[model samples]
Structures are given as C-alpha cells and as structure tokens.
Target: MNSKTVAELLSQDVTLQDVTVKGWVRTFRANRFIALNDGSTINNIQCVVDFENFDEALLKRVTTGAAIHITGELVESQGKGQSVEIVVKTLEILGDSDPETYPIQPKKHSFEFLRENAHLRTRTNTFSAVMRLRSSLSFAIHKYFNENGFYYMHTPIVTASDAEGAGETFKVTNLDIKNPPLNEDGSVNYKEDFFGKETNLTVSGQLEAESYAMSLGKVYTFGPTFRAENSNTTRHLSEFWMIEPEVAFMDLAGNMDLAEDFMKSVLSYILDNNRDDLEFLDKRLLDEDKTKPQAERSDMSLIEKIKFVVDNNFKRVSYTEAIDILRNCKPNKKKKFKYIIEEWGADLQSEHERFLVEKHFKCPVILFDYPANIKAFYMRLNEDGKTVRAMDILFPGIGEMVGGSQREERLDVLKEKMKALDISEEELWWYLDLRKYGTAVHSGFGLGFERLVMFATGMGNIRDVIPYPRTPQNAEF
Candidate 1:
C-alpha cells in the first residue's frame, strides 16, 4: 500500500519498487499520461502508462476527477517539469468523475463562477493553492502561540455579552421563528428561550479571552466569529475566523510589538515551507494583473509583498499624526475619498487606511491612540480624556488587518464608559468583577483569518479564500 502522497513520491532522489499512490486524476492526456493530485501539494505527479499493457475498458474509466489507486515503480521521469514519474503496474478505479457533468473543467473559470461552485472549486490549482496556504497559516498561528508560552484557550461560541458591542450579532434560540415569545414591549422574550436569556453567536472572543489572559498570563484564541452586518463587499463575511491574543501586563506599545512579531513569524513560516504554493499564487496574481487597468493593478507581486512585510518594520504613528497626513494628502484635498477626513475625531475609512499603508508609508502602518468616541469602551482612556490606547494595523490593499487595544483596567472608569454607552451593569457583572478584583494593564487584538488568507493569496474576494463563505443571503454549500 502506498501511504505516501504525490508530493512525497515526487520528492525522492532514488527509484522505489511496488510504490503506490492514490489520488484524483487531474487530466488524462494522449491516452498515456496522467496528472494526479491529492491536495498534498500544488504540483501534480506525472503518471505514465503504457496503453498496450492496460485493458481498453480500464483506461476508459481513468477520466479527470476519477479517484484511482495505482501500484507502480517510481522512476526518473523522461518528462520536462517533474523529477520523477510512476510507471503503473496495477490500477484500480475507486471513484469516477464524469467529464460531461463535472463543474470544474480543465480551463479558466471566473472567480464568481467558482464561488457559486465552491464545493468543487478546490480541484482547481488556484483554489487548491489558496486553501493549502490557508491551512499552513493556521498551523503557524497555533505553533507560534504554543511555543511562545501562550495557552490555547477556547472561548464560548454562544454568549450573552456582545464582544465590545462591535456589531450586530446572530441570535441563538430554540424558539420558533414564526411565533417567538414576545414581551410587553413586543421584543423577543429571550428569557423563555433555551438559555433563559438572550444569546447570540459571538462577534469577538477578545473579551472572554481577556479573562483567561489575565489568569493564564498569555493566551490566544483562534476560532469562528460571526457578524450580522448585511455587507456584501469583497472585504466582509457574515462568518469568519479570528486570531486573538490577549496578554497580561501588556500596554499599547507591547501590543504593537506582539502583533508585528506574530504576523512576521507566520508569513515567514509560509515563505519557508509553502514556497511552491506561494509561487503558484504569485504567478496567478501577475496573470490576473495583466487584465486590469494600470492603476488598478498592484505594483508588487504577491510573494514580493509578503517578503516586504516580513522584512520591514511597521511604521507606527499616532491617530493625530495620521489625521494630519490625511487631511493635507492629495486624495483628501482633491475630494477623491468618498468620506473626507475633515477633522480629528472622525473615524478613518478603508480609503484612508490604504493611503497610509500603500501611498504614504509604502509599507505596513500601525495607527494608535484613536478617539475615545470611535473606539470600544474597553480600550484604556488616555489622560486627555479624548483618545484611547487603541491601535489598528493596516496592510497594503487591505485596511485594518488588526484592531485591538490596551483594555480599561480601572473599575470606575470602565463602569463610567459602559454607563455613558448605555450598556447595563447587570449584564456584564462578571466582566466588571475582573476589573474590581485583579485588573491590570492588559492588551489584545483580533485579526480576521480570511482577510489574512486573502492578503497572503492575493485573492481579490473574501469569499474565494474561505471554504464555505457565509455572506448575507448566500449560504449555499
């Protein structure tokens, strides 16, 4: 039995006897050559067959997308690209894919069409490469946190506390949708529901992770987070994974250092281990760039940009400074931005963020100390009582890749902020207890995993990066 994947077999320096590989046939060409892949790597193993030795009926079943097991002798290839090939001795058809009915043809397909056929999209080289890179990035994230004395904590998926009140949340209830229990005010009476109180899919795990971080000293959560926003842009997803790391005794500066180091470590890992996949994606992006207008295309290739991020130090600027740069910038002055940056307390938009990262700095930028009104209530308030110890890491082409801050530790201040925001004290009693008892300066940040995948893969759409993207009004498998 050949337990080795196509990747393992192709990496050999010497030939092997009775070697077998099992995979889906990517293509069967010239009635002799077979391109087989098992999702182990981006490259396919060239399997050469002698048409005279195999029965005509058996060979007919070796169509594209067919699952097959081949027992053969691994030998040096007479081929041009690959180093080795398998000369088949015995072949068995495990499953057959009808070329007439299969959705994935051996040709270029639009990303929109691929997204609609997402279940079979991975069979394509582009998607396969993106998913493989996604898996590698996931592994690197956990590996980094684990090796750096951080505990891998699991936060609840269903919670009463909306994380930072960041956005709308999806309700989790057993009540019938048609006739939900209602209160005197006509609101859903969640008290009669399964949890006996209102609960929804968590928007962010940072708050819960913070409780653990306070105790564990350093901890991280890599899990699914949902948003109920009705956005249908290339940037937003109704459901996505988040990488959040909360640490005790860490302030804004320390938080910035941690975010930069963590991002670099993961990108460097992919560059070292997943170079082939990256190269494939890099080429894919360049080919895509050829079709776009000169201004719309990216100046740097995918791998080059990843390397640049890994090699350089992120430019850290205060919100005030960033505002100054944007207020007098060419885009704002010319009214190019749809939302103009007119004042200090105004929220920064995606256009503004991309400007700082791509045009102004020509590198990744970290903007810190945002206005208190614009930031979450948990962020530590500055002595000026205007801005918070908050920060956002901006990437080229992608705005706000990471958002986090040093949390408010003083019990009175936290309570005051919550009160001003009209958040009930009774609802977050436990969150307040953390401050009342053992509160210390702690900081954390949340990065959308899909956004990272999109950035890493140079995929234009968020839906293309995730396996089964959950967007508004689109949840088909």
Candidate 2:
C-alpha cells in the first residue's frame, strides 16, 4: 500500500482496509497506543498497537522521537480527541532514539533550552507550527507579488555597496586573517580578496531592486540580508530575510496604498489557509500571557488580532503630528520612556512607536514624512527641505514592521544628499547614472520576513520564528 500522511487520513471520512503511514513517534502510551506526526500538520494521528501480537523488542523501540513505519487497517476511532485511527498490522523501526540521550521528549521545554537544541527543535509542537506558518506566509508573499504584476527579482547576495549606510556589514573575504597582504602604507590589500575589492553580504536589496524596477516597471526582491551589529535583543538578528518591492512612477501616496494593501492581502491569506496552526498558536499565546501581569496581557486573541488588522484600515499620520502627540503623551510627559521625545527632528524609538500603535491609536499606524536628517539619503526630499517622504508601518507589540519611502529620483538632489553624507560617488556611479538618464518618481518598502512571522505566529521572540537564528556570538548549527 502507498504511504499516507496524517493530514490526508484525518481529512477523509471513509475507512481504508489497508494503508501505510510513516512518521516519528510523538508519544508511546500504555505500549498499545501511539501518537504519530510527520510534520504535515499540527495534529497527530493516533495509531493503536496490538502489543500482544508484536515482538517485545520491536514494541519497546516505539519510543518518543523514534522513526517508524506502520502498516495498518484504518478504522473509525473509538477514543476521544481523534476521529480516525490506524490499527497496526505490521510495524518496523526505521531509527531508534535513545531516551537517555535524545533531547526532545514529550513534554513542554523552555525556549532557551530549545535554542540550544535547534537542530532538533522542530520536533516540538510550537516550532513545527511556527515553521509551517512561516512557509505559508512565504508562499503568500510570492503569490501576492505575482498576482499584482510584479516580477520576482533575484538580487546578488554579495555586493560592494552599503545600501543602508549603517556601516554594520559582514565582510565577505577569502584572505587569511592572521597574515593578510598589505600595501606599502600598511593597509590591508583588498586587491588580494576574491572580488578584488571590499565586499560584504547585502544589507538590503532595495538599491538593486530599484534598478530592475526602472526597467521592469515593478519588481521585488525576497532574500536573506545580513548585518554585523551585535544587538542581542529579541528584535535583532544577525542574519534575516527581507521583502523589498520597488515600483516605478509611483508617488508617496501610491507607496502607502501599496503597503497597506499588501499587508492585508498576505495576512488575510494566512487566516484563510492556516486556521489550524493559528488556533494552536492562539491558545499557546493565551497560556503564555497568563504568567504575565494583567496589564501586559493581550486583549485580543491571535486570530482576532489578525482579523482586526485585515478588517480595519491603518491610521495614517504625518511625522510632525506624531512628534507633537509624543511630546505631549503621558509617557513622555511623565518621563516613563527611556528616550524622551523632546523636539521635532528627534527620531522616534520603539517605545514611542508602541505607544502610538498599542496605547494611543489602538491599531496599525502609518507615520510618514519623517525628518530628512533622520531618514536614509535615498528618501525623497520635501519642498521644505526639512522632511523626507518616508513612512513606517507600526503594529501592536511589533514596532516598525515596514519601512519604505518614495525614492529621490532627482539627480541633483540625490547627488547633493550623497555628497553631504560623504558617500563615495565613484563607487555608486552606476546608481547615479540611473537618475542621470531617465528619473521618474519611484516608491518601495521593505518588510522583514521573520518579523512578519513573529507577528503572525504570536511568537514573542524573533528568534523563535526563524528556523536557525543567527545572533551575536551564537551561530551554532
């Protein structure tokens, strides 16, 4: 008989005379019942074992985390919590896991402990559900872009440009570190490197995506991005995935419309397709919040929160208005914020963003027209020359989920901004050439993939949403 997955069997109403199912044993109870999962779904398929007919040695091998193949007769389950079950006629142990050494057991384990055993963390229910949701969200992103006439562009991973200009980039080199080639001035000779010049992992694909968008009309880059910052916070990751979409002949208003629509589309996809996983996570989050103080608890469930974001329109406010509100808000007035908002040009921190989204607006908020000095050099300069056409979408508990802007397409304005920022004109001659030739108003936004997954799965830590998280001093497996 052909093998069937737990998900397929659970969805069927008719019983099968004979079937084969292969998966790892989640739990072996009473030496007569087994809960099997193959990572196909959040729920496990129950397998009833006739231990009296089976050999003692084989029955004992049906331990937790053990790989096994079972051929059985499918029948209506008489037990609770399941509709159908497998009555095992034949059993084979593919791999045996020693209970003494195997790290994953049939019990709740702390996230910290699971991080240490990341290679095997998927065996747990939480991690498996998270991974499934992440996969679905990825597909939803591609589907949304493809349906919207946007071509998926593959930008280079290794490049010689600093897109963000933050100076926190992971250097890509093949030269020996202990004894590297040096010039007469005792400077490290980058000529000996593989690229014949300094290169690093890309921090963002927006620059390259823009080049394609100018020609292709609309294009998006979804790929891994790296940063060398040593932040150990739950929100920071050394390596993460980013979604950047660039559209030609689009203004700041069009950019905001695209961002809002794109977010709702992808989130609505999750709600429609991944209902089981969302329910599991919703309960998990409620249980987790029980340990926190009442004030810190979430008012809406995971499903309700996602539905709210989809059903309601995001609140839009200008940077000036947001600054005014923050300057007079209770947190800033009472000095509760770690970084107080004092003036107009001051950059808003995460605390201030959360206040606007969770406390003040009580919904998703889009703040635009940021101070030019605080935003990236590529953002479009306003007529007043004090602010740029940049916008950030802030969500409850997850601040700044999307950051983007209408790009500075004017050659003279871009050159002036770059020159004042001390950016090397020679290095970015090709980029400047795009503006020199045929510049049109272009807009785009970048959304961190893991951050979206974190928000969707109700996972607190960004590390938990990603499969293998990379952070400061931690890259194991």
Candidate 3:
C-alpha cells in the first residue's frame, strides 16, 4: 500500500510481488519502456508498461516530466543498463506535463541555460548531486565540532560593527531614501532611525564568536553573511555563508592545525558516505573536460584531487618566504602572472596562490605571518612590528579555502591598533572588555561555505553551489 522509493527498491535482495512507486517520467520510449526518477539517486528505474492493458489516453499522458504512480511487480531488468525494473500493472497520471512546452527534456543542457531555469535545474543529475553533497558537508561540519567539545553559537544577523572592515557590508536601515532626517551639517540624522545608528548585515561572526569563546572555551558560528560588493566574478558573491570557530588558549600553530583537521574530516566524510554523488560529479567534470582544450585539462580527476588534500599534509610557509619564491619564480620573472610579485608587502592574488599549490609546492599551503597592513585589525601583531599572525589555507583550483589568525589579546596593543585603523573604542567596548578581564591567546579561522562546496563539487562558479544566489543586478529564483 505504501510507496517505496527507487533507492529502496533497487537495493532489495529479492524481487517484490507487488510494490508501489511514485515519480516523474524522465522518458517514455517505444510506448513500452519508461525511465522514472524520484530524485533519490542519479540513476533512474525503468518501468515496463503493458501498453495493451492500459488505456491509450493514459499512456499518452505519460510524457516527460509528468508525475506518475504505479503498482507493479519488481523483476530483474532485461535491459543492459539497469539491474531491476518494475513491471507496471497499473498506472495513474498524477500530473501531466505538456511535451510541447516542457523545458527540461531528456537531453544535455548547457549550464548557462540551466542557470536561467534555476528553479527546475535540480531535476537534472548535476545540480541534484551538487546540492546533495552540499547538505552532507553541512552535517559533517556540525558533527565534527559537536564531537570535539565545541558549542554551536548563533550570532546575530544584524549588527552595528563591520567585523572584516572591508567596507563591503550591506546596510540595514528603515529610513526614507528620498527625504531622510538630516543633521545641522546635512549629514543623515540617525536619531530617528530604527536602531538609532547605522546598522548593516554582519560580514563575519568572528568578533561576536570571540566573546563567547572567552567564556565558553570553544565556540563556532555557521550562518549567512552579506556583502555589498559590486564585483561580478566567479568567486565573489553578494550573500554567502561563513563558518568561523574561535578557541581560547590557541596560538597560530594550533589555529592552522584546527583548520587542516576540520577540512580533512569534512572532505573524508563526503568521500565515505556520499560516494554516489561524488562519483556522479566526478564523471560530470570529466565529461566537461572533453570540451576544453587538452592543454588546459586537469592532470588529476575530481575524486583524486579531493583524496590528495585528505591524504597529504599542508605545507606551512611564511609570507616572507612565499614572497621570495614568487618574486623569483618563472611566472613572476617572465611577467606571466597578471599581478606580478615584485615587493615584500604586496598582497598575493589568486593566480599566485594556485601557482604555489599546483606548480611549486604541489600541495595545499598555509602562508602565515602576513604583513599587518594587509590583514584585519583583530589579528595579533608579531614582535617584528610589520607582520601579524594571520594565515590563509590555499587550495590548488580553489585558492584561499580558509582565512584565520591569532587574535590580539593585549588591551593596550589592541586599543592602539583600533585607533590607527579609525575603529572607535566606544563601538567595540564589549569586545575590549574580554581583553581587559582575562586576556589569553585566542585563535580561529573562517571558511566560505560556498567555496568548500565549489571545490568538492568541481563547480566553476560560486553561484551554482548555493540554492538561490543573491548577486549584483540579479536575484532570480
């Protein structure tokens, strides 16, 4: 009486005398063979319909994308591609999709076209596998933290401070744009605003998570973060998810250890549990590579790339040492790099990161002790006075998988850094109180949830990983 999923029926040890199944028709071939899928797995189950016993009208309605229910006997599949199929004794059309107007057919569709029809893209094999892996990775993250004595803390979505100081926060306000209240000098008067001051969606939860870490000992925040940047690149997203973990009494070395272990654990979980989806995505990427030039093809497959990260240890290099390598590397000397590494204090771009991971080091790399002027204000300053204890974990194809640092715990030094950066003492008085009360060496790191998904799924664009992407000039479902 109850319907069994395609996955359950396929995994059965014996043939069923009677089984009920519900799914949408992927294709109806020769008016006898029907390929049905229920979004349970990448493969579909064949339904052999007895066309003579069924009404001609009902058979006609079994079009592509039509929802159908069947009561049948499960038997060994006579076909070559499948192991088992349902011998349909009765069929009912739950929903009819017109063959003339159905956008998703049983043929290959371009990723660009799929993005336009984003609502139904998951019906295909690629997006469904990608989203399934996304769900699995999310669970793995929570599992790792919970089992390791970490508290899951929910940070506020709307806050008064820009944690990253990147000046890219999306403003949250309740004021009239045309005629807002103005001050004597014509500046916008926040006295009548909702929060009575300027507020924006939080860009990071690190600052708030640090407060909790001081008392809780170990805390992490996994939630949505927003940015108002207008850049439309493959890596940039206006709204994305971030994972930040803060630990008390941890130094820069321990921070790197946590990050590396966390990443390896999550990636390994997917490989062990979500092998079907991973295999599907791996083949999809390999097929996609056939369309590219051979020179640009990847030397390793998708699964191989993932296993490589999980098996090897990340190479830890100082920022100064990396700068030296890049300054004299063939790419920089020959002007092949878009932004050549020419100086000590220059920021490293994505190209430089990939060069280190893919060509030079040939493994994941953690570059630390970066120049203080290039990092955030909360990072601890080194005794050298020019660098901080910040670190970034760079991947081969996906550069900068994680960014974190040992936080400044000294009240006087933190206050000095805040003043130099124009960060007001009054705004972060509560944060400073953590240092004043019991200042200890604390460290944490943040990984963009979408970036991890991008690497794991071999998806080129960051937007494809998230369900509904919010980007500049586009917010379509």
RMSD of 3: 1.2
Model 3 TM-score is 0.98
Error of 2 at 455 (Å): 0.3
Q: Model 2 compared with the native: what TM-score? A: 0.98
Model 2, span 10-125: residue lDDT tens: 88788977889999999999999999999999999999998789999889888999999999999999999998999999999999999889999988899999999999999998
RMSD of each: 1.4, 1.1, 1.2
Clash counts for all predictions? 0, 0, 0
Which residue pairs clash within candidate 1?
none
Off by over 4 Å in 3: none
Model 1 agreement with the true structure over 244-360: per-residue lDDT tens digits: 999999999999999999999999999999999999999988988999999889879999889878988999999999999999999999999999988889899999999998899
- Please list the C-alpha lDDT of all candidates, in the order they appear: 0.92, 0.93, 0.94
lDDT tens digits, residue span 351-383, model 3: 999999999999899999999999999999999
Error of 1 at 338 (Å): 3.0
- Location of the lowest summed lDDT over 10 successive residues in candidate 3: 8-17
Backbone steric clashes in candidate 2, count: 0
